[model samples]
Target: MQTTPEHDERMAKMTFASVYPHYVSKVERKGRTKEELHAVIFWLTGFDDQALQRLIDEKATFQDFFDQSNLNANAHLITGVICGYRIEEISNPLTQKVRYLDKLVDELAKGRKMEKILRA
Candidate 1:
């Protein structure tokens, strides 16, 4: 998907903490636990619960959040569409990383097994 400068700027400016609760709600409403959400996050971004909480507390933007992460090598295995953009085809590195997390959360909420979600 083509990454527009404006969209990239907007996403980069958006705080992770602002959207975190929505992610929690999405997974929980699907009967998934917050632990499960954290597991997915850990698999994709290598942040444990404590680090994640710290990031949230810091009000880090999407840019800052990914900047501090050691993105999993297997993150490339996350493919498909999210928010109308194909994950593998996104041109912006930061935007792609954000969508990678989004796709992982989506898979978890959709009842995909953890092993598959983590690409294990």
Candidate 2:
């Protein structure tokens, strides 16, 4: 099966490490902390601190990164509009998953509590 090029460009082929700094910056600039950002990603992906660092250092592609993830069951609880797309309504499965992570990080940057962001 083939995935969309738009999806490939938007996120599929992007390296997690390449985009990670921006995530840290976005949250820290908003008065949040890197720990919170890490926590969000960890919660979503089931990666511990060591595993996440390893993935980043390896420059894993978004597809590779997610392929290694044991996505949390509660991830389905993440919903709402992001970047003009309704999270739950995204047609392409990979795009929807990527957007789900993006939406969580966005919420963290916007100052939502970690527990709430984790859907706890």
lDDT of 2 by residue, 1-120 (tens): 334667646777889899899889998999999888888998889999999999999999888999999999998899999877788877676677788899999999888888799999
- Candidate 2 local distance difference test against the native: 0.87
The superposed Cα distance between candidate 2 and the true structure at residue 120, in angstroms, equals 0.4
Global Cα lDDT for candidate 1: 0.95
TM-score (all chains, Cα) for each model: 0.98, 0.91
Residue 80, model 2, lDDT: 94
The most accurate candidate by lDDT is 1
Could you give candidate 1's per-residue lDDT for residues 1-120 as a string of tens digits? 588999999999999999999999999999999999999989888899889999999999999999999999999999999999999999999999999999999999999999899898
* Candidate lDDT (C-alpha), each: 0.95, 0.87
